[model samples]
Target: MSSETETFSISGPSHLTAIDWKNTYHRRCVVASLVQGVYILERDRQQNRIGSQKALAPLWWNFFHFQLNNMLVDSADHSIFGAIFELKPCLNAPRFVIAFRGTLIESGTRSRDIHLDLKCIVNRLHKSSRFQLAIHSIQETIGLAGASNVWLAGHSLGSAIALLAGKNMTKMGYPLETYLFNSPFVSAPLERIKDQKVKHGIHIASSVVKAGLTVALKCQHKQSKPQQDDPFVVLSYWIPHLFVNPADHISSGYIDYFAHREKMEKIGAGKIEKLATKHTVESLLSGAILDRISEPLHLLPSAELTINKSDSTNFRKAHGIEQWWDPTIHCPSLVYQYRY
Candidate 1:
């Protein structure tokens, strides 16, 4: 195995018993790192020209007492996008974890993954075969081991897939515990602003405009009001764990996303914010032009947002999956629960 794959061992202590799985922070860090192992496993598969002498899956998962149950393959490019890890009997972790790898820029699957990324930008990722396979795998896992014993995890593009799958399963009355590391939020990089006042001002202006548009669309019958049991409304009750880095623009928007909602409410604009939160600019524009309603993949009604406060100037390092597992980083988190 290459050195890249070797890094998977650094994710946790040499022995499983050394760490406390009951600790929320430790568990979150470990789960995030296991997702990294999936990334390495896929990378090794893509680069390995000859069959390896040692097994790859066991190398990473066995340390955590989890066996690789299945490999999630991308039908389009024949790339390994994710894997299902089944916990050894009597382990403290979830019985099964379904993990997806993000866009691997240097791998052969790059083109296919990037295509899906584009699809995600326009909210068409659900129609892709990869996502279909992911959801199917989740459904199968739920059937085998109840939802409580299942976990969903991913990074970047993979995180987006996990998010969608989690949402669908939640709508079906099965909500799985999910860990999304550096999940891409397709929107303006509002979190990039250095000045708090400027950022807050822009957020207020944008929220008001979006709320106004949403109300106008409803008045003109352009957008119909969602019923009481709408999937998005039901999704409010299924809160996933979202890990983000303010230094990474792709995922950092989530910081502003959740923060702005609270700010709007404090200013007595809660009603407007609520209306705007139901829709996205991309979805509304696409619905008008294409005559089809689509929800933005990144928007979530509720989430436990964990922000990594580590100072990293490099974008690659900032957005990397490895950061989540780094023991030295300072991570502050908050839970955003939306009430219907």
Candidate 2:
């Protein structure tokens, strides 16, 4: 990430509160599970994970608000469902998943080695991948005598890999689905091959907020204006702002990006030089990543978000928000509500 970005620009995406000014997505009960991110789930009427100073006062990292615990959570179904990997037993599902970790700390490895390993994230996302299909079966392979794998799902960076798999699945005629990151900081979306694949109906990677809208136009999903359900494609994203909010920064697992978070808090990010989320702003340099579709190369460095001001209650204070956001774009801004 650029030090230039660290100091000044308040993000347009972070300022956002509502996509459709007339309708707030958080108001309607959506079907997302807050298994570990408890605090952020019950946040303000707005999607911004911060509730109140009372709820926020005690923590060392005020912006680090999404709550996940070293505490283990269990599911009783004859299977294992988790953040990194899932193992299902005796389930007669046709597909299996070969999920790979994006980036994890591995002692004694050079940064070069670390970047190479991160490609495993994409390795699992190849389309029509028998290997990916076989990943979910590992659970049954060890536990049950014979259990088939089911569908595949990924969030954020993982979602991008899943999308890659969805495309291959389209060619091979397999059922695939995914939920990718919104404008990932990793790589730009593959467009030409993707745009032409519309009619064949490949497995699609749904979105929390459509990755296309938030990415640099160069990085928009590989398709033209997207439809809600095109298999092998990115999904729709609504509340793009919350993720950029200081509160949602910690939500994505794998703390490598935490370095920027830590730096931003200690040395306040300068003014919002430009909003990266609304359009494609170049991503911070890939800290340690090696991928075919890396997002950094195609970033624009100045994009604008389209938010509705009436929706926001305040202006953001560094150390208060989790993501690096600029206040000028079109969204709910904390500038009005906060004085810190």
Best candidate, TM-score: 1
CA lDDT, every prediction?
A: 0.82, 0.26
- TM-score of the candidate numbered 2? 0.26
Off by over 4 Å in 1: 10-19, 49-57, 222-227
lDDT of model 1 at residue 205? 84
- The sequence of per-residue lDDT tens digits that candidate 2 reaches over residues 193-270 is 335345112212211122333333325334343433322122122112222222222122211132222333344431
Q: Per-residue lDDT for 75 in model 1?
A: 86
Error of 1 at 190 (Å): 1.4
Q: On residues 1-340, what C-alpha lDDT tens digit does candidate 1 reach at each position?
A: 3554355455444444555768876687668767876877777776673344643545566666678899999889898899999886555678898999899887588799899999888788999999999999999989999999999999999999999999989888898899998999988877778999999999888877777766665566565656655556889889999999988988999999999999989999898888788678767766667665466788999999999898987999889887776667899889998865
Runs of candidate 2 exceeding 4 Å displacement: 1-101, 105-114, 117-149, 182-340
**294: Cα error in model 1, Å:** 2.4
Best by lDDT: 1
Q: Which ten residues in a row have the lowest lDDT in candidate 1?
A: 49-58
